[model samples]
Target chain A: MLEARVYVIMKPGVLDPQGKAVKSALDSLGFEGLKDVRVGKYFAIKLDDISKEKAMERLKGMCEKLLANPVIEDYKIEILDIKS
Target chain B: MLEARVYVIMKPGVLDPQGKAVKSALDSLGFEGLKDVRVGKYFAIKLDDISKEKAMERLKGMCEKLLANPVIEDYKIEILDIKS
Candidate 1:
């Protein structure tokens, strides 16, 4: 099995209202000195007996096709571990 | 400045239809052999000069109060950097 994480976030120029809300909420609560808060989606995936190469290829494909919207979001993938 | 990440995922017993949908989507798309998939929230936070000690304390508060649901989710925090 292979363990992976994918972090999906809005692209640099995108307007992030969810982030802004969190920041403002924090401000009200006096959690001060926060420069920014950008919220994103994290996916933890376990793949069954797939070769690393195939896993890599398939993972990227998943991100591009469904996991992230290429038009406005960016995604980073990390392979955490592979165990049989 | 400090850069941090909070990964929030549902606990083991929570029903995660979002995860199941993604897995089934992968199956339809011919990305076979996925053992399990869990989707979560990833927050990228930037703090302005709050001492790491204070930041740590506030971060935990954020998670408990708004960032995560104590009844269903578990969160992990990582301190990526503290830039001077």
Candidate 2:
């Protein structure tokens, strides 16, 4: 068994409206001195009996094909654990 | 300056339709041997001149109030860095 974690985040130059909204909401709620807030997606996946290198390759494929929008978003993949 | 990361995840028994959809998509795309998938929200926040303990407390309050739905989700906060 293998577990991997993926984080899909917006590129630095991209404008994140959702993140902006959250920042506004936080300001309204009195949590002051907030410099910035960026929101992203995280995924935890479980796969059956795969080697780490193989799983990383597959996970990147998954991200490129479906999980992330390559134009504006970038993703990071980490193999969390492998349990036999 | 303080930087923090928050992961807001669904409770263990909670239904995650988005994750299920992703799993099905991955399967169709030929990434097989999939067991499970879980999707969550990740937040990277920057704040001005706050101690780690105070920031953690405030971050928790933010999670409870806005970042997560307390009934169905749980949140973990990590202070990534503090720069004076």
User: Which numbered prediction scores highest in TM-score against the true structure?
Assistant: 2
Q: What is the TM-score of chain A in candidate 2?
A: 0.94
What value of lDDT does candidate 1 attain over all alpha carbons?
Answer: 0.90
Q: How is the predicted docking of candidate 2 categorized under the CAPRI scheme?
A: high
The best candidate in terms of DockQ: 2
Output the TM-score of candidate 2: 0.96
* Local error of candidate 1 at residue B11 (angstroms): 0.8
lDDT tens digits by residue: candidate 1, A1-84: 789899999999899999999889878887778899999999999987767788888899999999999999999999876545
Q: Which stretches of candidate 1 lie over 4 Å from their true place?
A: none
Interface RMSD of each: 0.7, 0.6
Give TM per candidate: 0.94, 0.96
Please compute the TM-score of chain B alone for each predicted structure, in the order given. Answer: 0.93, 0.94
Q: What docking tier does model 1 reach?
A: high
Question: Which pairs of residues clash in candidate 2, taking residues 3 or more apart in a chain or in different chains?
Answer: none
A78, model 1: CA deviation in Å?
1.0
